[model samples]
Target chain A: MDSRRLFSGSFSLKNIHPSVLITAVFLVAYPSFATDFFIFQIGAYSLILGTIALSLMMLAGYGGMVSLAQLTVAGLAAYLMAILGDNSMGVMGLGWPWWLTVIVSVLGAALFSTFIGAVSVRTEGIYTIMITLAVAVAFFYFVRQNYVLFNGFTGFAGVEPPTLFGVYWRDPVPFYYLSLVVAVGFFAAVSYCARSTFGLGLQAIRDNPRRMRALGYNVTLHRIVAYFFSGIVAGVGGVLLVWFNGRVSPGTVGVDVAIDILVIAVVGGMRHPIGPFLGAIAFVLLENFAIDLIDRERFNMVIGAAFLLVVLFSPDGLLGLWNRVRDRLRFRGNAQLSAERVNKDDPASSGSLEKS
Target chain B: MRNFIERHTFWAIVLLLVVVLFLWMIFAVWPDWLVEAFGRKKTFVNTLLNGVTLGGLYFLVASGFTLIFGLMRNVNLAHGSMYLLGAYIGYEVADRTGNWFLGLAVAFLAVAISGVLLQVLIFRRMANDDLRQTLVTIGISIIAADAMLAIWTGTTYQFSPPDWLFGAADLPIISVIKSSGAAVYIKYPVFRLVVLAIAVAVGIGLWIFLNRTRIGMMIRAGVNDREMLAATGVNVQLVFVLVFAIGAGLAGFAGVIGGTALSVAPGEDIRYLLASLVVVIVGGLGSITGAAVGALIIGLAEQFGLAYFPTYGVVLTFLIMVVVLAVRPQGLMGGRG
Candidate 1:
């Protein structure tokens, strides 16, 4: 609300939002401070997943469309990249340039998602979830069986990151930076777009599409566009995911993985752009380290537990919890606290607190 | 012909075609390819039996989900967890006491009690909110699944039914096909037939209870308009709890039967859950008749797909789900919610 004072900060959390400064610091000098290769690699993978989850958040948060097919779209992008680009696997790799492959993959993903959106957009709530989930399941099975197009269950291997400017992009630091930059760029783009008129209209439509339709907005078209944008974001993430793993397989785009994407989005904050990233970091950390704590097969229990706890207790996710604590602290410490102020400023009073 | 046409409608026509194609595929097309492995007549009979039995299993699971959803509009993703739990309980009971029937009884009671607890503790607090209830159930399902895995391990397990009820029984089937008018004895699993009978009995009982009983009237009224029913001084919470318990009990019972027929493992929960979803979606949510038709179609499609197009075994069911959702989210049974 206070644009002038919003960004003004002298090493104080009170003045400037922490994300910008933290992001900038990570962007410029992440390699020097955190030189551990595996950490960066993990960060890169998390950022890719975070970006994918962020795309889910874009639809679920703003558009009120909870799609379980975001991962499928990402998988489609990755599959296209593998098919189009050079791969060691004995499949029909068109062997196109990486940039061209990226373009085609992202575009193809958008088209595929728009089609999915067209089919599912008519339904509301649980039906939409069911339709999207069914699509994900169908895609998973289709890829697993379609030998010519998807190379069957084995999938394509050796989808390494392309070298550019005489630099091997697959290196830990470089890959991390690439993923981080992409993730941050998309995150910023979403944040900015969410504040714009189109984004406001979308949020309004999400709340009451029928009302918006009565007001003369093309509800279905707006929904299709939302899916398209979400698809682009997911497509970028997919290309990154494939490059990061150096392979594409059915396991990567599995039903469990698709559900895990929802877990990540839900465990982050479905309402905030940054929520996915927060959830992703937590998820990636547990995925990497939690294996030491238990057998690999039971790790799902941990992830599921995390997902449940977040959804049950704090549906807004970790970010929501932080905001709640911060708000309480603000009230207690700022000396502007009063019963009347509480009544006036409480989000629940104004109906901003979404009843999860 | 007029009465048939009147009752059949467009869906009936489509249903007839599907049945014809299903029979035709097995009787005509399959003989050419699979005769070498599975004799044509045997394969046809086996696939039909498999589809019908699988339909019974799906009906048991989907009916409970339909009831819950119709009443509360809550999608209980944990329904499958209850199935897995029931299977494990049955396995343990049969292993200890060696009474399969007792194991089933105990499993049903235990799961029903747990379902009641789930309704009271979690679902009740959610204020009938879809997302909240869905999320909470997902959590409980996770916890239940993990607990089951921890206790029983990841290995698939099945409890043996009574020796008399188990194994194949030869039954004479008189076919009019090929104008033979001859009777052929087919060896079909007796246990499976029993399971189907049980499913039918449950379905009939559910229907009768819903239509003829006082509680059934309340349930129908409650499902139609929860607020109005509650405002009229009926105990809606009690109905919710009973429905949840019955649904959970049915799922648990189905688990035992399904486990006996096929086997229960870590992912069985999700598989049955997916089956129930397909059933409810295709059958039209909240409608028992829809659930039955949905289950039959899915069962037949699944079994047929597995036999013929092995690569895309479950794809047919998911395809049906997607198509139905696309064409009519209301489903074949015209479920209201």
Candidate 2:
């Protein structure tokens, strides 16, 4: 699942994989039969978080830059939407249409992420993590303090979705579908991009920056572009997130959420495009239902234990475990040998990070 | 612009200090655009002392963090969690027994044990995998923070020093020109001064241990080349284990001190974690000197910001980090990025 031929020319969805087909069918039918709790709590929240995690996965997985600021980007988008679009909070509402607000928000986040990447790209591994994290924490404090720009700690509270097509998009089914469409579109885009020439080149750089530079590629530019892509994806998630909750606040982009996104991506398996959504579904379910079994206050403990276990046993995440199980069920020795060979051959594909 | 500075390291470092000094003077002037409350000279002295004390606490925390990073290359994100753990432990102990020294010992020992477990159980397996180690530490931190909440609840807690150390001490920073005579005074918390003394002792002892001992040399070597150290017949695992525990234990120690100075609460773990991070970045990673210098800079900026610009206190710490990273990604003393 992690490996592909360097220059594969085949891109067809005609013969859809069973797993993909099954998931799509379930998502399409989810809103009709599911209860409001399941639709909003499980469906909408999971997809929104999944999309944000997916953005992180794209950068850390493909571009080999682990950033702890995707949530900041999303929060920024949410804040922009609240300010630029009409909202009940009555704090600097520009009364712009939702579509224009979204476009502007996403583009603005893209620019923001690109700038963040530019500042950080010169540093390797741990420095990137520290810089991005510092920036994110800084943004959180800035938002909490700057009342004029971010409405202070208590941010905009009413950010209802635009009623396009005479259907109040905040309705459970409509919102669920909206989240699904955006998530699926980004998932597909990331999947396709992973196979494209630019993606392969990006992966090559991730593996050996020196070699790629020798071969005449602007490694820094590629890394920045990857961050920008993730920024746009995260921005979309942010807009959808505000619509789902109908609010935006400093808490929305706090350090907890920032790390939560990282945990989701890591737990899902950053190697594949679908890993983040799966991770998000697991996370959302845990967040939503685990409180019944455990104390509500200790929820982070459960997530932390689960994250540690997942990382310890399978650094490739849940998908890696699934692949391992599948391989074991197949002609055991051959599958094991082939898997080992693939891992050995392409370190970047396996996400075995090597500091530049 | 950043590349130009990186290429000219000495000049850039000087330029950074000059800018910081200039900003300090400008802010000290209390221009009309700034807040209007801080005209008293005594207040500036109080703020400066607070900065030093605060910096001392940061050094206690970040020293361990940078040492672990230097030796094992593992980013212990749980360092702050350990701090919180220590604070809580000290609170419970001191609250029960009413003995400050006993509470300090227990806090250190308990956090040390957990640090050892963290090394042996989690970070050991991830060997040289910084990202995975980071993820594991994050998980550990989350678990610890939640567990603290479950036990301590959401309310903030504090462990005051012994009654003897509670009074304020007069620092002779300013002189009064009354008709009686000139008397110097800036009354400061005796407990804070005690904490400062302890922090200084730890810093000096740590510096000596690293530079004047065989084990310290081994650790320095390990940070530079773990493989080489292993190849030369050193038990690198033992070194890693020892360093991890020391780093974690230091954070725990800082926790109780910080708790007494400023109450420990639910979110203080992340707060200290972020503070130490800023300390390491500005000071440069791995070196004791770097950690000390960085902590003082952060402490001063933070205290001054809080006194003059309450809203922008935390923002100043982050701003320092960004400026440092832009000019020198390797940090003030970091030889390697």
Candidate 3:
């Protein structure tokens, strides 16, 4: 029950590395067998969602901050791209190149996120969630009405994907591959960051901000950096989303979708990198297949039920369930071997004890 | 002087910007008739009345939200669902009974029971964890929405008051303007008047309950420090159940009133939930006074924005929220711990 014992006992490589490798392999190979529509619709969409959820997981799991506005940050990036890109022809138009717009959008989202983080990181737990949620609501309304800048309720369309290697880039296969590459890159980067000193500092803050502050760590700065990192990941996902949908609407960043990202992160298991992908897969599959099985109108009922069940039974998520099963099997084998060793070491002593 | 300057700085800047923006907008949409309209005292009174009527409905919805937050710190994401449920149930009841009053009563009771059952069964178990509570409530909301969708489809449903309550009344002061070019018309709905009266009564009742009663005192205590209440041997779980139920019931009542004001639609549950959230955030969570103030601000802004600046109507609420949070993160009334 001691803190040191708990920390030592919780540490395990078998639960972490194998799962990550398996997930990476599955993700890399998923697009190969998927149909063109499936690749674009399910595969690409899942990756975009996974990436967003991963950002949330990084903040919530490591930094102990459950932000409900990650989607808003992503939405901001998308809105920025739509407003700043070459297609914008109305008032507030800035006919910037796609690359330049993309960079600006990402940076804008990061800066906005940093500002939000600065205000929110001072609060703990539920208050932080509410603050970010308020921000999301504010932004949703802002975009819905600001026609000059965000194209108002009827958001910008005709946002063509950037061409790469003579391909239209709108093709499902290519887009899927593009999403895969980006997701992989982000996954690697976030995983690397998680193992770094900065990540450790965030974890330390999560555990005991007061203690970490006493130890001379800039708690606020570290929290802000974490938010910036999370924003970057979400912003990239936003770019991919706009490209995938070929349009950006206010509904894309509404409270429901914001909450969905939290659900996906929680469902995937927030503790590890691969959890988001796993969660995304579960969500995408359920969304695609559940609607087919049930009436389309009642599909949400099914999803809601699944969400409640998952939260109540598996708080660590699907990944945690997998790890537990693996651990149990390993323990069983070890228990049998240890019993055999005991028998061999003292056969006479064991027989007498058994008779007694 | 330093404290005074700092305290007034944000508001002063906002006021200056608002005035400049207003003047610019007025100039851009310059109409010769504006001078006459602005000169009329009756028109000004009507506009103020419009704002008050709208504020009443907002207060009705937001009161429940603030109460739940104040009592249990658990954000009932599905509060809107209860509202939706109330409207739908009210509509169905009215259709069957052919009596609007009875239908309203049935809707209120139905929603109140649903709230109580949800608290006793689902929310009671999830009270310890906020995230889990949110997730589960979201699930419940989604399921409820889907259920409503499957049953009613995406079609909008309307509710009407009795035939006797459908006419407009002429006021003596405004009657003078009727003869002139400025006809200050006041078309009133009996349902709206009833809603306003009920909202005020409920507000007063809630104030008394929270301030006067033992259970209400327990709820207030629980809201401030739930752990401390638990340590005092009070059954915190029971208090939470009651609070959640009462909150849900309030939302349901608002739903019936709101449905009469607007049409009950499938996706509107989330929209109204967002609206209520804005009210709570702006007014400050867990404070009824905050909810009332937040609602009035939002309602007035929404009404005025839609009336004069339709393009900016949606952004107006958000702009208010952002400005409010920027200036007073605790909200206008300030949160209770």
- Across residues B1-337, which tens digit of lDDT does each residue of candidate 2 receive? 6995989999989989997974564344334443345566567767877899999999999999999888877778888999999999988998899998888888988898899998887777767678778877888888888888888889987676778889887765542334576654567889888878989999999999998999999998998888999999999999888988889889888889899988989999988988888899899888788999999999999999988887878778877876887899888888876
lDDT of candidate 1 over A1-356, digit per residue (tens): 22224323323456655666787787668677775655465678889999999988998888878888999999999999999998888798999988899999999998989988988886676667766876787787778887877888899999988889888988888888899889988987887777667777888788778799999999889889999999999999999999999999999998779988988888888767878988898998899889899888788789988887887788778977886787787778774665556566432222212532
* lDDT at residue B301 of model 3 (Cα atoms): 83
List the global CA lDDT of all models: 0.82, 0.85, 0.77
Q: What DockQ class does candidate 3 belong to?
A: acceptable
In CAPRI terms, model 2 is classed as: medium
Tens digit of per-residue lDDT, candidate 1, span B210-241? 99999999999987899999999998999999
lDDT of 3 by residue, B136-255 (tens): 777788778878888888899988768766555554333234434684544455556666677789889999999999999998888778899999999988887777767777777788
Task: Report the poorest 10 consecutive residues by lDDT, candidate 3 chain A.
Answer: A347-356
- Please provide TM-scores, in order, for all candidate models, with all chains considered together: 0.89, 0.91, 0.84
Candidate 1 or 3, higher lDDT? 1
lDDT of 3 at B236: 86
Off by over 4 Å in 1: A1-19, A145-148, A151-153, A291-298, A335-356, B1-39, B174-185, B335-337
| 1 versus 2: better lDDT goes to | 2
Best by lDDT: 2
* Error at B149, model 2, angstroms: 0.9
Clashes (N, CA, C under 3 Å) per candidate: 0, 0, 0
lDDT at residue A222 of model 1 (Cα atoms): 88
Best of the candidates, TM-score:
2
Clash pairs for candidate 2: none
Displacement of residue B92 (Cα, Å) in model 3 is: 1.1
